[model samples]
Target: MLEQRGILVPEAVRGRITRRMDPHVMRDWFRRAFAAAAAGQVFGDE
Candidate 1:
């Protein structure tokens, strides 16, 4: 989704996401990606 919008996902962030193992959290991030302008927005600040 970010790629479709031309937003680049940094390699470090990609690595972090790659290590993420929770399906619920991944689902939430996937939904949020549609509205996020940045990678940080997907996971929020929590």
Candidate 2:
């Protein structure tokens, strides 16, 4: 799908993204993102 849209991911870029996208890291990122979103909602979106 990405290739069909002309979005070419270079090998280096792919490698870096994959390297950091471990289950633990991804979970941590999602947790932080969700926390931020919840905070924003509570704060009324400054």
Candidate 3:
């Protein structure tokens, strides 16, 4: 959706995220996601 709205560039999403998101928040989010995956939690199944 954001890509279609031109808010995100597909090729530059990684760099953009790093530049736009707070580093601490991003790190925390990644940690949670990884932990969930490791614990065998299924994503987007609700």
Candidate 4:
């Protein structure tokens, strides 16, 4: 069963966050910003 395999553990495999508190999007933005900065593009200041 899934429980025996730990596949049904109480872990967050998917989530929905508020627009203002979307950590996944924020992380992606940070990644893109860092990449842009590294490539000498104009990313906004922190």
Q: Which residue ranges in model 3 land beyond 4 Å of their true spot?
A: 1-20, 37-46
Off by over 4 Å in 4: 1-19, 37-46
* lDDT for each residue of candidate 2 in 1-46, tens digit (9 for 90 to 100): 2333344545664555467747765565445444443322222221
Q: Scored by Cα lDDT, where does model 3 land?
A: 0.41
Instruction: Please report, as a residue range, the 10-residue window in candidate 3 with the lowest summed lDDT.
Output: 37-46
Off by over 4 Å in 2: 22-46
* Sequence-dependent TM-score of model 2: 0.34
- List TM-score per model, in order: 0.80, 0.34, 0.33, 0.34
Local distance difference test values of all predictions, in order: 0.82, 0.44, 0.41, 0.36
**TM-score for candidate 1, residues paired by index:** 0.80
Global Cα lDDT for candidate 2? 0.44
Per TM-score, what order, best first? 1, 2, 4, 3
- Which digits, one per residue and each the tens of the lDDT, describe model 3 over residues 1-46? 2333343334444454557567775565455554353211211221
What is the lDDT for 27 in model 1? Answer: 86
Prediction 4 global C-alpha lDDT:
0.36
Scored by lDDT, the top model is 1
